[model samples]
Target chain A: MTYCIGLRLNHGLVFMSDTRTSAGVDNFATSKKMFTWSVPGERMITLMTAGNLATTQAVISLLEERSKTLEERDPSILREGTMFQVARLVGATLREVIDETTNEGQLKQDQFSASIIVGGQIKGGKPTVFLVYPQGNFIEITQDTPFFQIGETKYGKPILVRAYDPDMSFADAIKLLLVSFDSTVKSNLSVGLPFDFQVYEADSFAMGTTRRIDENDKIYQAISEGWGDALKDAFQHLPSYKL
Target chain B: MTYCIGLRLNHGLVFMSDTRTSAGVDNFATSKKMFTWSVPGERMITLMTAGNLATTQAVISLLEERSKTLEERDPSILREGTMFQVARLVGATLREVIDETTNEGQLKQDQFSASIIVGGQIKGGKPTVFLVYPQGNFIEITQDTPFFQIGETKYGKPILVRAYDPDMSFADAIKLLLVSFDSTVKSNLSVGLPFDFQVYEADSFAMGTTRRIDENDKIYQAISEGWGDALKDAFQHLPSYKL
Candidate 1:
């Protein structure tokens, strides 16, 4: 019921996520799924969530409370030593929320499960990304597999698998993610526009450009319409079958 | 899992199905999911299956036996009065198979459920397609929705939505489908090469070109490689985002 992408390029990390959340086909709302915490020059941690809204919001609120309460016993994601540690704390928080929510109910634990994509840089550590599972485990992005996608991922994946380039500019990367997200939005009703995106430069350790693309954004419209025309054109260029 | 598509065009109907069937990620084998029954100059019917292999194979075998036996009480698909009747018969047969399979033990009925895409033309009937559900019901393809895909369909759907044209030539349709299937095969291990395809021309009342495209097929290879390049080129043509 969501589509989120955390892509690691050679230059930096690019994150995009749809804002639509639905309890049923007829009930829908726009909710922000991207969260960020930065310490000026010390660290920058960006997290994108997909799955149960309550679990994700709880995890975010817990992390926020821990970070804001200077004397809290719980570790703060803001103060984590590295991106991996931040991912671990987020995973633990997700698991803790799911555990708490399901303990008093007859519902299955998976009903409240959520996954997170946590990525950023610590002052001395290299920029990277991790996909945190609902089980409180996570996997880091690698050279061979440089991106992570969660929820309603398949429709947009073919283009990403073909067009992703490690050394592309932030502008081009955004274009690629938009094309990917556009495919998903067109095919699935559960994922919609007003997408949130953030760009993190590799060594900056500070949050890069953060913006939201809504339905009327000129660039989004152009890409959405242009990509369809371009795909038809590209399809035509392929050699015809001899039947 | 399987991936099959049935597309209706102005000229006629096109069907393509992957041969891969898997019990799990590690257990896979090739199996034919496309079946055809033709009464020359009278009718031409093609059916594609996706879901439980046992149920599908049972339905196909039952259809074959009933059609072959001269005095069988059960109606044969080849003897149907209209394409709609043929689809109804297939749906009933599918439901029959699933019911019989699930009645013997503790296995859930859903475990034996299957879906079918049946399309063809009979005398005095227009070419059409129908998606037959597991409940012995179906809906015909309309002008607005000219195609049906079952199982592992999302990865390959965006291109079909963008590139499909009812008025296009059979060669173009095949090319379009090959591009769609190539996207699927590249992205999913459950859907792979050796795709089986059948083309039925309007008013032919007989089978059209039927073939299997394996890994070495030059055209498949060309499309598989060319589409990646074409997509990359198409992505490049989209305007870069202003970040």
Candidate 2:
């Protein structure tokens, strides 16, 4: 299980992902799920994956392996003219990986599958975010669902649903995301810390800010403590039933 | 879709449920998911259901029908010897109803399903809560996972994960639950307003507090607004990365 969020806001884009993966409760491991293909000032494409670690890693490897080829590498995440095309390339690669793996009778019942959050901008396009489904298709983050979450998404959805807005400040977006993640971690042991987060300023054409929030991070500590206190206070203030 | 929660606290128990049910985006209707069996001062039991309205209604009908025969029945919510027995009765009844309605020919992948939260106490028993699965088996809420949620649970889980404690006051438990419900209603269209809630005081052997919260309810509005603002405030306070 994993929890990854990509938010598109007036200020910019924020992507956060946890780094824990497990086939089951007893067989847990830590693996980084966020991969960046950045040409620095030219284009920056970030991909966060959830589901089937082997499958996701295989998809990433296949894409990287293809980009090294001469003919098949034209629409790479680094070479694509638009973020949409880059998403397509990633989707296509994911489909190809699943087909190859499954055709060999190595996987069963959608076990060799993955979902990716692909977000970035090329040299001439606006910043965009997309939730790439397991079947090699994708949906963009619209105004109504200004955010897209993948992997263990339900546990953190309420906060995003209530707090996310297209016009939110970047700072507020990050905090809401942290709280959302905190909620998920508490409820589910499958997702855990050292999260990778990247914030991009609108039209910056570069990664605006990237930080790794670890278990001992100060900001997270504050958010955790502050959120708990705030909730207790909020609960106390609600009107009780007249009994 | 629905959102129902049951909490077992040292002081008492809390149960809350939303009133919305939907077959799809277009076929939505409101039905109360909560039912109570109280013999004034002898025993008080609250049951909340989620999943497959037809199945849930069937289970409730069976329970109610059985309650009618309590004078001659061996095990009923009203006639059970202990809270544990009451839970077992509910689970066994759910199983029987499910089996009666479903057979091999009628089985689909998602057929014959409902989960219930049963909470309260008999005269000599302490407060207790159980999460009854669709299989007609159940698990009691413990200090570790002191709360049980059924249906549309993910959207409301963040708040509960952060705020729930075995030792929380009854008033605090109710407030926390409302906040959790508020979060769910904000996110999922399937779970909506006009909620039924009950809070039982330990040892009272009767319903302590019960109310219906609607769209325009003042406290509901307060928690909604207060939580939204608090989340934004907390988000804004987080330190941004220096890039």
Best by lDDT: 1
How well is each residue in B1-243 modelled by candidate 2, as lDDT tens digits? 789998888788888999998888999988999999887778999999988888889788777775566676543567778878988888888878777778866652255678899988888778889999877778998778888899888877777777777787766677788888888787778999899888888878777778898999887787788777766555555554433
Error of 1 at B81 (Å): 0.8
Candidate 2 Cα deviation (angstroms), residue B176 = 1.7
The segments of candidate 2 whose C-alpha lies over 4 angstroms from its true place after superposition are A66-75, A103-109, A165-172, A237-241, B66-75, B105-109, B165-169, B237-243
Which run of 10 residues does model 1 chain A get worst, by summed lDDT?
Answer: A66-75
- Cα lDDT for residue B115, candidate 2: 88
Query: Each model's C-alpha lDDT?
Result: 0.90, 0.81
Second chain alone, TM-score for each candidate: 0.94, 0.91
Residue A172 lDDT in candidate 2 = 72
Give the range where candidate 1 chain B is weakest over 10 consecutive residues by summed lDDT.
B66-75
Tens-digit per-residue lDDT, A1-243, candidate 2: 899999888768899999999988999988999888877778888889998888899888776765466665643556778888988888888877778777665553488778999998787788889988777889987777788898898878876776677887677777888888988998889999989888888767777678888989887888877777766665665565444
lDDT of 2 at B63: 74
Candidate 1 on B87-182: residue-level lDDT in tens?
888988887888777766544338788899999999998999999999889999999999999988999999999989999999999999999888
